[model samples]
Target: MSAVTAPTKGTPAHRRSRARGPLLSKRLRMAGLYLAGAAVFLFSVFPVYWMVATAFKPVSEIFSGTPSLLPGTPTLEHFDRVINGELIPGVSFWRFFANSLTVTLASVLMGAVLSLLAAIAVARFRFRLRTAFIMVLLVIQMVPMEAMIISIFINFRQLQDATGVQMLGNLTGILIVYTAVSLPITIMMLRGFVAAVPKELEEAAAIDGAGNWTIFWRILMPLVAPGLVAASIFAFITAWNEFIVALTFLGRSTDYYTLPLTLSYYFGRYGTEWGSIMAASTLLTIPVMIFFLFVQRRMVSGLTMGAVKG
Candidate 1:
């Protein structure tokens, strides 16, 4: 054989090249995954960041031809105007905040209590049309709230006329709507939590001389507390940020208007108050953030414990 014969296909050099091929491919896949994750994170967080940044920027920088990611010179004048300026003549920002807080808290509390009771009935007791009722709840959720606004508004007016109680132009109507709107989803979420609790636990509690009330309060309620917290957050946010319902129900009653309605005051016939709008939006976001932070532990615990089987 010649001294310069060609190398065989199964040489060590060829094997080494094959091995490196897979490693390079794997590295490329990992890099693509990392890039996609970074893109998603930036997409989700950028709007919130922009809103907060705009809130702190001065008017000149806010309307600048080229927008900067960070404010060159931050200022608090917008916040002061939002907090102290009398945009609604006599109504202060605190009044709108109080209205929103009252409606949101009431709706969340009522929704949680009603949903828990209904969930218990659905999970534990088998009555007629129980399946049908659950289906109806799903159907109700599928229907858009905008589609029902007219009928709901009409029914409220009729109820007010028949009962001589003022339902419109006040917080009561919107409160009822928010609670009702939140009920279906809340009940569905709580039903799973209630059903996850084993019947044997209730039997054992009963054998230990625990009454129905005691078993429910001590055993069922505590286990379902996490789910209740999650449901309450949904109801709270819905009621807090709702605009069209509150606008329609409250009518021209500025005193009864919520924080969402107050944002419109920043948009005038002349031009939009961009800084004040962003500041108000920031203020609107703080309470929800605080509420979630307060209950985050319970929410996390619920997620971790939800998977265990009886």
Candidate 2:
């Protein structure tokens, strides 16, 4: 009979084919990519990790000759010192915290309001010197704060003299400085966002009898909310972490200290308290992280806005 087609025995060579090797090669390439990314992440994150690790270490362990990737025994003592007002003998952390909160919040809020309004005008309306005004802002931004510090200090001092106010060492003074410094960039940035929203929509609103303010509030603001969020985060971070101006203006007033200035308490003529300093540094980073988390969604959306070409 058909001597049978007993299952074709042509198979030994075919069975041994090296198909899996190519799949394994692809897996190896994927693994290599994963390793490379992990290396970069670890490299970037290590210093921040070390700072927090060092912060939690005991004073004795911190100064020990051997370096450590992880502290042997983490202690809350240093943070307790900061909380208890013993980190710096005379500085009041709560008072400084309050000052920072008030100044940062006020400056960010006022800047957002003023800058958004200016951005709408610049983006939607044509006026004299409009281009020149934008160019002037760019040039002013190019000038380093160090160069302007003296002039700003003098100007604020004059304001204090004229108003009989402590413009050089108070919340009002710091807020004004932050607002002015942050406004130019904020306005420029929001201008693009305002420009992105179609003018036709605004005209439609106007035709429908909506007033300028109503159209802005109902139609425009929500459309550019992402940009507003991004700008607020930028302004908040800039003002919150500013050390030079704060040091220059708020130096004499410990009560006016922001978190960054609070770290100066750890410095001593004899030797710096590295442990407490690290702890303070760790604490200083927390607010920034929180602020970023709060704005992260809007940041992503704002970044995505550039994808809209028209």
TM-score of each: 0.85, 0.82
Top candidate (TM-score): 1
Task: Give the per-residue Cα lDDT of candidate 1 at 301.
Answer: 47
Tens digit of lDDT per residue, candidate 2, span 27-46?
56557867999999999999
Overall local distance difference test of candidate 2: 0.79
| CA-only RMSD, every prediction | 9.1, 9.6
**Per-residue lDDT of 78-133 in model 1, one digit per residue for the tens?**
99998998657788989988999999999999999999999999998999999999
Error of 1 at 195 (Å): 0.8
Clashing pairs in 2: none
